[model samples]
Target: MATPYIRMNGAGNDFVVVNALETAFRPTQEQARTLGNKATGPGFDQIIGIEPSDGADAFMRVWNSDGGMVETCGNALRCVGWLLLQSTGRDAVTIDTLGGLTTARRAGPDQVTVDMGRPRLRWDEIPLAEEMQTYGIELQVGPIDDPVVHTPGAVSMGNPHVVFFTDRLDDGFVRGTGSLIEHHPLFPEGVNVGFAHVLAPDRIRLRVWERGAGLTKACGTGACAALVAATRRGLTGRRATVEVDGGELQIDWDQATDHVLMTGPVETEGTGTLSL
Candidate 1:
């Protein structure tokens, strides 16, 4: 049978969303890969399954284009939240995922704000191969004496991420450096790589090479991780605007609660049905 699906994007990180609340459905890894194929199926950075939840408005199952099931995706959650808000006519909604539970609220006509829980800073949390200070890990690229990029901050916003703060945002630099560090021995689980340039105390220009999904236009968790990493290094304030290839996002790491809040816009591309 053909299952209905909705195509949505949050700040250019697009997804194919399946509402399984009424009729439960979960795609296998192969099926996910097929749907993510641009030439063959509905191309997307990730695929989200919105299933009924006992504890929250919905349970989100996320799969990357590579067919890997991941803990969470901030942009996918925001898109799902918007769908729930529109359907329930509520101002806010709660979502459950393998990573954790998060709450999303209406921020504007096409915008949603998600409260991504506290970041995990411990080596065991980011699950590095060994114990080390997450604030800055001793990893480098290029020559030993004059490395191109080094001393990146590591953290987990439900998923492992490492951010390299550098002046280099060139396409070749980001891709070359990001691809090398993504599967480095330090991160036990493959990590999402971020290349960021601090424009000011409250603004950053960022790019991300996502694990399982390479070089996305926008990555919600990557933006959150960037802000957190920058704040930890005393480079940026607790709150800032992150400019990604796709668009802009507002990220705030609450001092009191330690939760990161991401606000961004979501757009519906269209709707379609897919054979599962």
Candidate 2:
């Protein structure tokens, strides 16, 4: 039998979502790759499996195109929220994942706002091998003396990230160095790398090199993670506009709630059925 799936995009980062609330089939790593293959199969950056939640509203399993299981995926979660709203007729939905619980609410006709929760900032939480006094402390990478951009603020949004602040978005050194820092030995579990240029007190231009997905058009959790890092480092305010390659996202670090709220748009890029 063929399995039905929905193709969706949040801030331009695409995904394939499968509802397994009633089924027991869990796609293997190889199966996930086959489903994500653009040439011969359904193309997507990640594949999301939605199962019954133990305590929360639902449970999500995320897999990158390369067949690697990921702890969290912000863009995919927004897509899940859309699906949940359609299926349950509820404006608010809570999703449980390996990372933590994420709450989503309908913000507009086609937009969803998610509370991504607090970011983990300690070196141990980021799970880095060594301890750094502060997340903004500098680190060396490769043989490039006077390294391109150091002193990045590290945070974990269920996954690890390093946010490097720059004066200009078009700086020449980010691309090469981003890859280097992503695999650097300092981060034992590897990390998603972000290059951010603060355009204003409440706006930033950002680019990301994901841990397992490489350079994607946009990343929802990355934006939230970056905002947390920037605010902690005094580079920007609690609320800011993060501009990615595909589009923009409004991120607010609500102090009262102690959660990161990410508001963004999602698109339906048609649907397909896959036979495994």
Which has the greatest TM-score? 1
Cα displacement (angstroms), candidate 1, residue 263, comes to 0.6
Query: What is candidate 1's lDDT per residue for 99-195, written digit by digit as tens?
Result: 9999999999999999999999998998799988999998999999999988989989999999999989888888888888889988878999999
In terms of lDDT, the poorest run of 10 residues in model 2 is 167-176
TM-score of each: 0.98, 0.93
List, residue by residue over 68-117, the lDDT tens digit for candidate 2. Answer: 89899988888898889777889899999999998989999889998899
How many clashing pairs in candidate 2?
0
* lDDT scores of the candidates, listed in order: 0.94, 0.85
RMSD of each: 1.0, 1.9
Any runs in candidate 2 off by more than 4 Å, and if so which?
141-145, 167-175
The clash number for model 1 is 0
